[model samples]
Target: MIHPRGIKSLFLLMLLFPGFASAQKDWQDFMKQFPDHLDISLLIQDETGEPLFQQHAGKRIPSASIIKIPILISLMEKVDEEHMHLDSLYTLQASDKVGGAGELQHLPEGSRITFRYLAEEMIRISDNTATNILIRTIEMDYIQHWLREYGYEDTQLNRIMMDFKAIEEGRQNYTSPQEINDILIKLWNGAWLNENSRAEIMHWLKGCADNSTIPSQLPAGTVVAHKTGTLDYVRGDAGIILGDKPLILSVFVEKFDSMEEAESAIGQIALKAFRDFGR
Candidate 1:
């Protein structure tokens, strides 16, 4: 049985994208497999940036490492403008260490690293230490201003990753599925950073080691350039799924009963979209 909210969502999607009515029905029906308690926000667009499906995509929630997307973009913009060089080095400090999904914290202090290395680790491993370093190097205030200037009012990187005190103070980073999809679409269309900058970012994203979300259940050899975000109660994956019909997909699952279940549901939803779009 479709949840009442799902029914309303289906109606709106059909009304918004009439050509996708049949596909929407199939996908929405599959959505019933997820329990009503889970908060799932999703946005799927074709290469042209047309929304094929969405649900609560504009509802902002804790972003986890997904906030890195904007940070990465901010850094790349500086590089494109010749304001920063990827080859430039920044030395690590004891204060820069944080406990989370990265190896940088294990490295000794005083280890000098390049901006390119920091950027790569930030995306490829969701490195909290690298992220904090880049956040400091790029200036958090500028990133906040850039987000507002671009009208991403719902997305903000207010605190460094894995900062427990900040979390206790409620200074968490937040973003919505729609916001992420919009960013990825621009990146896909060459509307954001220069070609080289975008390519470098994509290279890092494609190598991301976390395959437990969107890419978990995909057929082998699928080319997916994406980022995954995880916290105690939030799980998200946003990326460009390349194929005959290239797609931009962002799925964020929050407030779930089980981590395993949440990740499984995300993969199932993405796989369903892959099939729907491939046809």
Candidate 2:
């Protein structure tokens, strides 16, 4: 049975589509194919912000690398506002390396990199080292204030990437499926960002190296600008799927014993959304 919290969103979907009942049944059955212990949160919207589907979308979860999307936005906002320049260079320090998805950690200390390079690598490779560099450069306080000012109260960057000490202290980055979808909506509509910044953001996202989640089961070469996140039992993917009927899909899965199972679910969900909504 679907969680009670999802009923409101399902009702909204039913109101928006004439054949939603049949689609709902299909999704219900599809969800049953996953292990019962697995938890999923999803939000699917059309390019115009119409809610196509939602399931526990408000449930905040460990964002893992998905937090980088907001960091990217925040950085771009600063760049556009003239508070920072993308061409500015930062030197890597021995203290900056973090043990996670990235090659920058292995680079020798004193390596200099541009803000643009760090931003791109942070998304393209899910580079934790690069992410930390950008986060430090942007300053945690300003990022937090920006999120709050922009109405992303539930989405937050509470700790830098790979910070075990902060995690032990009960601090971790987090975002909800709905919040992610909202962010993607802005990107889709070209809101806030200047032309060059928007182009650069989409370019980096389209180049995301990890296609093992939402893009795995998509049609070969389907254009999806997305981000994937992983942390122990938690897994997620959120981005724009450009095609006949463009879509913004954000999914988070947790409490699963197998990473492959969680990721496969993510892929299957995206594929189903593509086919179902494309019709």
Candidate 3:
């Protein structure tokens, strides 16, 4: 007859070798399959808003256009308070054009555009000209005050669209991945803006023009509301991961030698984080 101790030993071995071993193997395989030089910062939390994994979470990096999140929020707050109407008209002047990934720069001077369209272009397309007009209309100080009021201690809008002065003064722009994730979580939970405004903001986020990072790795039907910021050697993506479970994730990479390599590294890190914590 078989000894009970032998059976117990085999059971214990199975218990020790399965799930943990599989997890380690999966992580290792991911790391080996994709190798590139980049600074990766990620934060993922569970459906209950508990943190699941974090890497380089506290580091600050140039936000690029991702700083537009607070700008969007601040603008929505004004709409929520009825201080500004979405349909309110703003004239686009020659000085308002900043010349980036947008068509607004090509429009004639003194052309009129509604706030709703400007907000859409700003968030959905990262239109630098539209962002500049909104910033000039709303003012940076007010945006900063809104950030402080919303408990975003680490978030800041230090400049207007393509402002060379601010960039030269060592205050170009910056945000931590953690703070971006925090903002996303609050927005997802309907706490960042009013319920109607929150829904509207998320709707705009869904229309983000850039999708070369996290969205590129996700399945066809996966819903990710994200904003992407790109400079020569820096790429950042921040948004909500909506799946069987909803979580906020922000991955920022900086000082990459090549944009393509940096993007590939960010994609690999995003895929790993999504598979691990996205359920």
Clashing pairs in 3: none
lDDT tens string, model 1, 1-279? 222444476578778877669777777888887999998999887887667777887788888899998999999999998999999989899999988789999999999999999999998999999999999889999999989988897889999887889989989899888788888888888888888988998898899888898888888888889999998889899998876698899999887988898999899988888888844
Order by TM-score, highest first: 2, 1, 3
Residue 123's lDDT within candidate 1 is 89
lDDT of 2: 0.88
lDDT of 1 at 276: 83
Cα lDDT tens digits for candidate 3, 1-279: 112332354356447768644654565566555445556666665544455455666677788999998888888888898888999888878877887788899999889889999989988889999888788777889998877886666678888777778787888677777677778877788775789899889988989978788787877788888888887656988888787777677777776777776677767776766777677
Instruction: Choose the strongest candidate by TM-score.
Output: 2
RMSD of 3: 8.5
**Model 1 off-target regions past 4 Å?**
1-19
The candidate, 1 or 2, that scores higher on lDDT is 2
Best by lDDT: 2
Model 1 superposed RMSD (Cα): 3.7
RMSD for each model, in Å, please? 3.7, 2.5, 8.5
